[model samples]
Target: DAAKEAIYARLKKSEAGAGAMHFPLDRDAQYFEQLTAERIRTRYVKGFPQRFWWKPDGRRNEALDCRVYAYAALHGLLSMGLNLNKRVEALPPVPASRQSRNDPRPVTAPMTASPRRRRMAISSNYI
Candidate 1:
């Protein structure tokens, strides 16, 4: 409950232009829909209240899940004593030569790793 509240608060603040977080200008309607697919619901179980985010059937919520995971990751980083603001400030500006032509941002090499193959068990019934 607390975590969900915190996430909503941050999102609200950002939407109100009072937060450092910003969304891309190219986000589509479907993206926004997925981002807000879930709603908070409370139910009583054994006289105890249980709160959870609920989504209707056939609704996709990958965006919301990604946001939650991102918030958790940021919380984890802060708990580890990493000053993200300071780290951002300490970074040097990108040189014009290093900047991409299409986007005014520095280009970084794509991360690549060999895919790991997993072993699967076969049942005699299937065979």
Candidate 2:
């Protein structure tokens, strides 16, 4: 939620910068809220630059989401690549060899794939 708020601030500033690129206000508040939300998500989940639909010109723009850009510019370089399964991944593989006085063995388990039903659950809940 905090990041989302920050995204809102970024979007607001961006909207001002965009001038004519902002999403149309005619749709209603709910639509704006929805658009704001997606913008925030795109920042972290997909890297940077959120999407917006401008009503004045009825065009979609991929304006640079400065908030995300700043975040990624600072943090992305340091992070190891994220594994896709890690999002809901259970754990790492267990050790297959070696032993220790304390019965040394890897305890982490690999992630389980989401069942089809559960897989679809995300888009519905979050979107």
Candidate 3:
């Protein structure tokens, strides 16, 4: 029950833009035992959900339902004892030249794009 509340508090704060919402990527149950308000808030900010910013209206602006999937995936990773930070670090970085200067794509656009079109280019995978 306490764990749920902590996560909820972080969610509320993140929605209100009160602070950063990054959570630790570790799944060790013991890790959560050491969480303080400030620490959990930091973890939430760094978690997958933070990558998809909420709109000013406190709604997800992304069309991909990232909040749902990101959280789901986070928990899944946690259950498997996987380190999100490691997975992220292992992935290749995106080049600055890949981003378009004239027409910036919406944050949700990538997931909403047709799978076939998305595979057309490596940059489009996350564009």
Candidate 4:
């Protein structure tokens, strides 16, 4: 897809040098943790001015009298590159039979029962 390719190109541009770019491990449990630390270190080393925006409109902008600049991070670009070859699939819907209990029947008046006889002598019923 054009969109996917565009994103890939931007990411490649953002990281620039081959040695500066990171290769993420797909399906790894510690991938995010490691990637986050690496991104933070890269940004910290590059500082505010040296960093490049990962998106097309992400660069600093200035108007009549106001100026705006966005913070840059390349972990997203690395993530996109790592997942570019994979197809995302939506999770299957939950079955109706597995739904929570929410009984709709109306409640009826409680049934009354006769009280048991107190201190009754042993009778033929007990025998």
The best candidate by TM-score is 1
Query: Per-residue lDDT for 40 in model 1?
Result: 91
Model 3, residue 90: distance off in Å is 1.2
lDDT of 4 by residue, 43-87 (tens): 444465443333323322122011111111234545556342232
Worst 10 residues of 4 by lDDT: 63-72
Candidate 2: tens digits of C-alpha lDDT, residues 11-109? 556435632234433566555544443432233336767644233344332233444465565456447665545543555443555334355334554
How many residue pairs in model 1 have overlapping backbones? 0
Model 2 lDDT at residue 86: 55
Report model 3's TM-score to 2 decimal places: 0.30
- Candidate 1 Cα RMSD (Å): 7.8
Model 3 lDDT per residue over 1-127, tens place: 3433445467556353544465445435444432322222322555543322223433332322334456677778699888756666665665576556443542221233587766786676676
**Per-residue C-alpha lDDT of model 1 across residues 1-127, encoded as one tens digit per residue:** 5655676667666344555356676789898788878889999999999988899999998887888888888889799888867766666776777676467454443323333321122233355
lDDT at residue 54 of model 1 (Cα atoms): 90
Candidate closer to the true structure by lDDT (higher is better), 1 or 3: 1
Instruction: Between candidates 1 and 3, name the one with more favorable TM-score.
Output: 1
Instruction: Please give each candidate's TM-score.
Output: 0.65, 0.20, 0.30, 0.14
Ranking by TM-score: 1, 3, 2, 4
CA lDDT scores, all candidates in order: 0.71, 0.47, 0.47, 0.34
Give the lDDT of residue 69 in candidate 1.
86
Stretches off by above 4 angstroms in model 3 are 1-4, 14-73, 98-127
What is residue 10's positional error in candidate 2, in angstroms? 0.4
